[model samples]
Target chain A: MKNIRMKVARTEMDLSQEELAKQVGVSRQTIGLIELGKYNPSLNLCIAICKTLSKTLDDLFWED
Target chain B: MKSFFQRNKVKDERITNLQNKIYREIFLIVAAICVLSLIIKQLNHGYSEANIWTEAVILLVSSFYYMIRSTGLGIFSAEVELHNQASKRSMAFKNIVFGLLFGIGIGTFFGIRSAVLYADSTLQSIYYFLLVSLVSFIIYIPFLIVVVGITYLAAKKRSDRAVEKELEDDQDQDEHK
Candidate 1:
């Protein structure tokens, strides 16, 4: 499923996909794919994104 | 924006290096085959063959060219980095597995055919079958390795180009925004 939490947080922070991708050291397409649920980001990448967004893994990746 | 361009430039260089390596390697391999053919012809005293001198000259020239061309390339001079390593690795692994399976099928088919069609006795048939299988395996595995290796390099180049294009597009979009 799409990471709705990531979308919500990114929009909240007003960070574009490219900006987040750059901060996470991945291609924008990778970030887009992850957001769209077309690709699964690795655990390292998840952590990177969490760190960049100043959120915990449980907040962004974990589903209730 | 600037980082995207820089990353793509580095990736493009790596891909170009890989592409050149693939071409050089394949050229050398083909040249080697030609040389081997020439040597076998020479050993057999040009018997049952048409014009050994012509073949030898062609092979010699081509082999020299490939050797020189391959030497000109700076392969593995530095550690190569690939952005799409995971997908490329997965593709290469799949190609090798499929190539091996296909090779086995071909080897088995030829072994069975030779054993059944050309043998004088049951014992001779079994020996021929095993021999054929072993020889075919030896030949097929390397052949598949070369084929798959070239394919992997070509796929890598394509993906790298795609990434560059994507980065350029993203830059343009950002500038407009």
Candidate 2:
């Protein structure tokens, strides 16, 4: 259930969880939780994360 | 320009969640210590109303401080709304239930204390406990219901207004942009 795709995208962008969280106006722990599949973010937050990572929701959040 | 308090305020949801969790734990620890101390005092020197005053004051002050802060931050109303929505319960009903439970807890505590202190025989103690508990419950239930219900309504109104203002501000910013 971990968001491996999102983690990959973030690493590819050379962004740490803290840096990505700052960009999304959230805490590092929130980003970590999302990646760890421990938290389900609001659509607004999801959109914000997608925008920051330059990825679509399907690319990062969709379960195949 | 950000005020000193505003500048240092934490805006992150996760941090706020963690802080609330920690605060609850700390409050529980303090409450346990106060109860332990009260028990120790009662055992050593018998039941004096003065012995309870310190613990009562500490508990009341902490509760009031938390309520004020949560209300100011709109967290109290939001939490109440969330709980009511999730449980599919009306706010008034929930408040009444809360009042009743609170009354029962206080009544039980006072009943036990009075029974222990004033009753000479076991039968008398049982009689005293029931009488005192019933009286305390009757006195506190209505008072708490009215007070808590009014406070919740007022806080919810304030929170709604704040949310509206924030939406208007956002709309204004979008228009300006």
- Clash totals for all candidate models: 0, 0
lDDT for predicted candidate 1 compared with the true structure: 0.68
lDDT of 2: 0.77
Scoring only the A-chain of each prediction against the true A-chain gives TM-scores of: 0.93, 0.97
For model 1 the local lDDT of residue B129 reads: 94
lDDT over C-alpha atoms for residue B161 of model 1: 55
TM-score of chain B of each: 0.44, 0.63
Best-performing candidate as measured by lDDT: 2
- Looking at model 1, the pairs that clash are none
- What is the DockQ for all candidates, taken in turn? 0.05, 0.04
Question: Could you give candidate 1's per-residue lDDT for residues B56-159 as a string of tens digits?
Answer: 67777875554344323311110112233325555556767888887888788789988988999999999999999889988997798778777556545655
In order, the Cα lDDT scores of the candidates are 0.68, 0.77
Residue runs of model 1 more than 4 Å from their true location after superposition: A1-64, B1-89, B171-177
Candidate 2 clash figure, as a count:
0
True contacts kept of 1: 0.00
Q: TM-scores of all models?
A: 0.39, 0.54
